[model samples]
Target: MSTLELECPGCDQVLELDAGFAGGVCRCSNCGTLMTVPVEAGQTAEVVKQRQRPARPDRPMTPGEAEAAAKADEQVYTTTSGREVRVGKTSIPTAQQKKRLMVRTATAVGFISVLAGVLALAGMGVWMLSQAQREAGERTVIEAFEYSPGANPYDQRLANVLGLPLAERVVVVVDASASSEVWLDEVNAAIGAGLTETSSASEVVLVYTNGDGLHMHPSQPRAVARWRADQLIAFQQGVSTAGEGWLDEAVARGMQWLPRQMVLVVGREPSEGELVALERAFEADAAAKLDVVAVDFDSAALDDLTGTYGGRYVPMTREQLVRWRER
Candidate 1:
């Protein structure tokens, strides 16, 4: 049978009736109003229909007469505004969870800290080793500055200044000015003596600053010394050209190689700009602890130049040349 539909007279709520109970009185589902179904003309009084519910096979059924009986059993609390709220029980964390989180965080932090500390120590060790090597190299050169055998008093002092320790790599810059011609032979001897002491050198560069420049390759210090002597002899024979000396260009050329190497300059004064550049160069190589030595005619100017680069200036004596032939 089709269902019957009707609205409540008091609340106008729509309600459905099973066709089996067409002429029935019932309460409205929404407004709870007592309502009467429209009966046939022959029927007089309204009838009430009863609904039968099936029995539950699994569990006992609760009566639906009260609204509270159909709700879940939960704790209800009344707010200050008189509204009730229901809540279920919640769980609290135990000591184990908190301790586990703390341990993991501490472990991560400690691991990172330890790694950083190890890297820092490694860097420091490398720096210390390099410094030690540089100090040893400098000491070797300074110790080799002892007085040569049978050298004159003035020549001996000059030799002390000129006899620098040759490093693994060496750059020898010679001033080829007219005024420098007289002591060129002594300069040549000092170069030879230094070279003899630096037998450990792998490469040697000789630069003569005359007109433009003269360069010699991976040569022996003794060979370059002999060559300088020959050039001096040739100069005495009036075979050399007369030109202004460019010591600045010679120093710049000497610094073209690797940093932290040895440089020996026998020359006149370099320009202030060149002196500044040389200072920066040495400063950059200071970490490597290289040596720079200069022997010049102008003692004061050489002092300033050497001071700029953390090097010392040694005064040259012409008397050194008298015993130059023995070397």
Candidate 2:
């Protein structure tokens, strides 16, 4: 027998038996209580099954039996929530039900895709903004445009007034080859970028060369590189800008410049003379760490010289300069 588990809807008492036994009064096993379990009129799975089967040629239900079967066919699956739910083979799914399921699935997928896209865009935006902010916070700027050779130039005059501690110095190298009206501002910008007033110490020097190169600033705690800026400038002013382009010599002169831990601001690639001079200088001193940090103001000219001895090369853009200065 297909046993069914049931409950007394009134007394909360559990009963286990066939639904066919739900005829009238049922005696409760607990508390010796008697209860009435309602059975739908003429409704049973057997009755419903008989109604659905086509009549056999040899045998058929009687008139009353046929009437009871017809009534049973109307029975539905009743849930605990008191809703009539279709459960058997006669309950074919409708087009409306299929359409509703499809719509729900599509909507879920679309919503997830949209959410993922939104998160991806937000992540990318945050990453880019964070990087730009980081690079922008590099260093502070200062003006020491006092390197002009004559008339106690504007830059020199300002330096004298500020009398900036000898510890903080800017070195400007003078070139004998050519005068650079187009590139002077660019070189100045690069050099200015090195000026910082943080816990780290910095001393500025202006290097110059007509035939021989000079590297000088003032007051160093170390015994190395004591060349004075004014004296070097005086020597460069006499260098006839007639034979060579000033910017070329200036870039070449950069390699000859001093201040082991100072900035070497230049316009172009160092000339052959400057390279030979550098090799000889470092070769001769052996233990002398003639550190040169070369910064290229001209973006077109930055490349690894000989694929070795890679010096510090910083390429500055106008926009980057403005952003760096603002910080």
Candidate 3:
């Protein structure tokens, strides 16, 4: 058997004429340039003057293809006669292409996620602004009422103002004077405003002492206003005094019974001696955390006591005490 060798005219590459390759297009081994192998004799071959070419290691190839060529160049084959042969091959398309597809898919998903987050943030901002605007468009209001008393309208008003819907500690001390019948009207009016019927949430400690520095009912213990309102009023009226002022005496007498609370005082101030006694007792009691408030209807003598002991001294005027709660 004989074999024929052919040269590619386009790239000057060498090709071989196989058994079925004569008279047909054959590929060049060096350049892969197509060349028509001359099967017929006396055929004019198109030729051009070849310039001196620069020495190159191999044909044009990518890194992967060069690695494949290097691997192929390293292959040794034993001939049937025990000889070695080196083979060179061109690279083909990769069979496993899933990795490139996955990378492209991951990049596209990341872009979509960023775009969604931006849109969500903008939507939340718009919703919050809308809610705030709606809230600002709504309404706000407060309710208020007035109180009046017979002797100390401000004190009764103070009771009503402070006692109404009362939440914290509140204690009231009323003087059972000859004018207690008139003063009970003030008490009833305050009850009409807002007083608990049975709840002693506030400790109502009443004073039935008389003027002239006398303890009329010294044996009777202090009682809640809801239960002893009538008794306290009667106790005040029954024990009439001979111009005797028990104002200071009452505070001194009541100091031992004092507890922690905002107090409401009723009736007029007692005589100077009694008033002095009351202030001394209050200043002492204040040290024990008791708040003393005196509501003087007959006279504002209790104002000095109220001021002296840092307790509230409401004037007899309704306008004055009503304004106090407002402020």
> For every model shown, what is its TM-score relative to the native structure?
0.41, 0.29, 0.35
lDDT of 1 at 88: 24
What lDDT tens digits, residue by residue, belong to model 1 across residues 178-295?
Answer: 6666676666555554443223323456666666455443333322222343443443333232365565666566666653344545555666776666667566565323333433
Q: Name the lDDT of candidate 1.
A: 0.49
Best candidate (score: lDDT): 1
For all candidates in order, the CA lDDT equals 0.49, 0.39, 0.43
TM-score of 1: 0.41
Query: RMSD in Å for candidate 1, one decimal?
Result: 21.2
| Cα lDDT tens digits for candidate 2, 106-217 | 9999999999999999999999998875444322112323222121112222222111212233334434334433343433333332222122223344554334334333
Evaluate model 2: give its lDDT. 0.39
Evaluate residue 223 in candidate 1 and report its C-alpha lDDT on the 0 to 100 scale.
Answer: 26
lDDT for residue 37 in candidate 2, whole number 0-100: 38
